[model samples]
Target: MVQVMRALRVSRFGGPEVIKMRQIECPVPQVGEVLVRVRAAALNPADWKLSAGLFQSPMITLPFTPGFDVAGVVEEIGPNVTGFQRGQAVIGWTRRGSFAEYTVVPAGVLAVAPANASFGEAATIPTGASTAWQGLFDNGNLQAGQRVLVQGAAGGVGQFAVRLAKWKDAYVIGTASTSNVELVRALGADEVIDYTATRIEDAVHDVDLVFDTVGDATLASSVQAVKRGGTLVTIAGMPSEEKVQEHGINVKSFGVVVTSDLLQNFSQMVDDGALRLLVGATFHLEDASRAYELCQGGHGRGRIVFTVSK
Candidate 1:
């Protein structure tokens, strides 16, 4: 008899109501992949957006699982894989199959979990922190002592951006609602702008980099804050090439790149107390619908997670 695992599946694109749980075969690891018995999984913007068909990329197939971040114990490894042992705790980005009891991912994306953090907290690292690392360092090319502004700094991705920038020794400024101003500041932001009370342009200007996590009007406003030769990078929306050329500023919008090295570095950072993991709320595997609902609201405090086995 084949073993079965529970997973959240989206058969059709719609609202939070569309997510449903189904019991399917427990996946066997293929060559160069590992089978992780998921202990916890965290939510990202893509969770609800994909569920709503808003970010329907070619990579997605119908009736697929929604989660991208997972923290769990390695249950088994496939042929041609080495260095990881069974029962070791790990966290990494999944290929869209993490909202389940068991999932398989390429070994290249797996990294040892931080010894100091819980499964729920570890689950938050893969997508959010990797994006932050790529956005600030790779794409934005933020340098130490340079001024960097993180737009919407209180959200999931924004929080990590602020912390990572601070880690790199950048002078960090962030924008958040009044409720999250102090929180952003406490996360090592040297300056926190209450976006509710002030326009970004009015409060700050001539920054070396603007890390915009909020798009649309906010992203448009952030360009004014960047120095003439500075860089503006956003994960939320694509800036027009014309706008970037007209201002003569480097602009980048990109998806997260998950690598074993990146995940290992993040784990070390967490263990060394250089980075903090914030879990705003958690739900049982059965209550995933409720979890998705809260995330869809776009105001949940930090990472929203699902406790799958623990």
Candidate 2:
């Protein structure tokens, strides 16, 4: 018999109102795929952006399930897969969508869950942390003892950027609103600027890297914060190319790439106590509408996750 499962499907591009929960057939794993029984699914701003017509992609089909990060157990493995076994706790960046009881994950992106973290905690790491990792080390080439300025320091990716820079022995400066000033500081930031009180460019100078998670005007001003030959890496938006040229600095933009190797490295960090994982809020899978609403409105700290099962 074909198994039926509940999923939060985005039937149309709109607000949270467009997300509809319905019973859908469980997807079967194909070659190089694994069927996971989802224990938790983490929500990203991208999810809401896609639903609300703020982001457009040719790959997004209508009536799609609305998540990427998931923590679960392998229910079955498909042909050509190896290393993963049934009933093993795992986490994945399921491009197939995770807002369902089960999601089919590309085997290359699945990793065993971190022993030290819960499902909710594990689910948050793939997207936000990887973006931070790629932006800082891969793009910015950040070095220890150098200074980093992170705009939107209290946000999900910003929180990880602060800690990762600190872990790399870099001095970290972060900009957040008043509510998140202490929060960012607590995450090993050497300094926290309240964005409401001071301009980032006015407060800091010659930073080794400016990692911008907030775009628009702040991204423009961050060019002045970097030292000559330093780097600016943004996951938010691009700076004006001509303006960047005059500053003698390098600017790069990237989207996070999730893979089993990356996930495993993070898992090791969790077990070694060098990294901390967090979730701002959790909802039942059936309450996905509320989850979408909260994520769309913006979260103050950590990732919002859906607890799909025990």
Overall lDDT per candidate, in order of appearance: 0.89, 0.89
Model 1: residues >4 Å from true position, as ranges? 240-246
Instruction: Put down candidate 2 lDDT per residue, 1-310, tens digits, no spaces.
Output: 2399899998888988888889999999999999999999889999889888787778888878889999999999999999999999998998788999999999999999999999999898888888899989999898999999999888878888998999999999999889888888888899999988998778999998999998888887899899889899988888898889989998989888988998889889888999998788889977778888888766367789899977
Give, for candidate 1, the lowest lDDT window spanning 10 residues: 238-247
Pairs of colliding residues, candidate 2: none
Q: Write the per-residue lDDT of candidate 1 for residues 1-310, one digit (tens) a residue.
A: 1299899999999998899999988889999999998999998888899889997578878989878899999999999999899999999787748999998878999999999999999999998899888999999998999999999888888889999999999999999889888889888899999888998889888999999988988877788899999989988887667877777788888888899899999999999999999887889878877888889888767789898985
lDDT of 1 at 153: 88
**Residue-level error in angstroms, candidate 2, position 206:** 0.4
Stretches > 4 Å off in candidate 2: none
Instruction: State the lDDT at 41 in candidate 1.
Output: 93
